[model samples]
Target: MSRITFEDLEALDDDDFTEDNSEPMDEEEQDRLFSHWQSVASTHQVSIPAEMAGPIQQMTRQSNAREPVPFATLSRHEKLDEVVYEERMYPAGKWACVTKGEELYEQSISMAFMKLMRYICKENSAGRYLGMTVPVLNEIQISKDGKSFVRDILTAYYLPAEFQQDPPEPLDPDIVIVQREPVRVVTRVFFGTTTEETISRQISSLWELLESTEDFLRDTYIVAVYENPGIPCRRNEIWFIRRDQ
Candidate 1:
């Protein structure tokens, strides 16, 4: 029989000691922790301070319909075709809670959901908001007028979700601080006007604007809020971020 040397024994000891013993997170554990919080939020019914409710509702109404016409959008679709468009930036950071939409089918659904989250955060409160972190590219659908915007508001727009075999995008949850502000959008398609040409043009323009403005990214997108789609108007937001870097 071969005798093990001190070094060999030490190596064995180290291997035994270093094995990662961290338990995998099971669904039960996740639910146990999360359910408690759910109960809390549900019980507390954290109402937006009365002062902030009107703006939130108005902003929601606006997101559902009415954004300034983006003359610059016409020039966008004329540019890039299939790529994930461009990364856009806003002036300020906002806080958000990511929520999902009904009958979600793709990761884009979740992305749009988080995007809405950011918008909702801004609209809900009058004061600045510093919110969550963002991860990946979700889906996007273009719109032109109020009726379509309202449709998106009702339908919850494009769903932001992950694809099968795809990893969940990383987000900072409640880490980086941000200052919340309004957001805007512009599109060419409207409710009952889902023309390929119009949707294509408006979608192209929005991507272009995002590409142009990415330098101002506060950090990462907090979340995509779902707005029932079908309201209209070219949208854009005057925004700002107020977190100490």
Candidate 2:
């Protein structure tokens, strides 16, 4: 819904290796330099040059592990937990996420996954590379038609501890940085692939359990996937945001 303006293009420095001819950049070098910026722009659905595909793939591999947000499990339900998420101020940083999706769970999840991965491959406005982090969060909601729809899928990579003072702006519009205040939540962990029936069942169970409790109140819920897809056994959790007492 947003247009890439001349100023926007200008802001993203063009890869001009041919200008000086001081040894052309090789595949690895090209990826190190321009791939991040190209991927960032692409997250916003902006058109990029064909030559960058190779570098983009290279960037995907660079996405490894980073520091994750810390929390403590207050109570355990098999593999799941009622977590007391540590009260910490989430530093301002760009989170690559998609706000729309299809009605089906798998289809919608796949689309959101691609968008977030594209954001990871791209560089932010500051030209700094962000390391990938785990537990991609997907917020889901049920529609009036009695069908499940993904409200928004969020893949947030934590900015390094140093970026606490000032984080770089996202080059792409879809990747926006905002501060998150601390909150409490009840979470139910599960494994294997998530299906529509599974989601419905889980939502019902978490709500029922919460309603019986005296203190906890549900404002909303989020679906958190911790492992990469294709992993035969992946960890997933449904998080119910608890209202302030």
Q: Which candidate has the highest TM-score of all? A: 2
Compose the digit string of candidate 2's lDDT tens values, residues 1-245.
23444344445433332122334457886654454444334434444456545334444344344456555555554425454222222233434455545545555565555555555555565564555566676766655565555454444444555564576666556666656555466777676556667766777777665535544533345777875442334578777765562
Question: What value does the lDDT take at residue 117 in candidate 2?
Answer: 55
Specify the poorest-scoring 10-residue window by lDDT in model 1: 150-159
Model 2: runs farther than 4 Å from truth?
A: 1-64, 77-96, 144-147, 150-157, 207-219
The number of the candidate with the highest lDDT is 2
Off by over 4 Å in 1: 1-56, 60-102, 105-126, 129-245
- The models' CA-based lDDT, in order, is 0.29, 0.53
Per-model TM against the reference: 0.21, 0.59
Compose the digit string of candidate 1's lDDT tens values, residues 1-245: 12323233323322222222334435664443333223222222221223433223333323323221111221223334543222233332222333333332222232344354454344322332222222211223323442221112111221122111222222434222223343332222222222223444444454454544543333221222222211111122212222322
Worst 10 residues of 2 by lDDT: 84-93
Report the number of clashing residue pairs per model: 65, 2
Residue 244 of model 1, lDDT score:
29
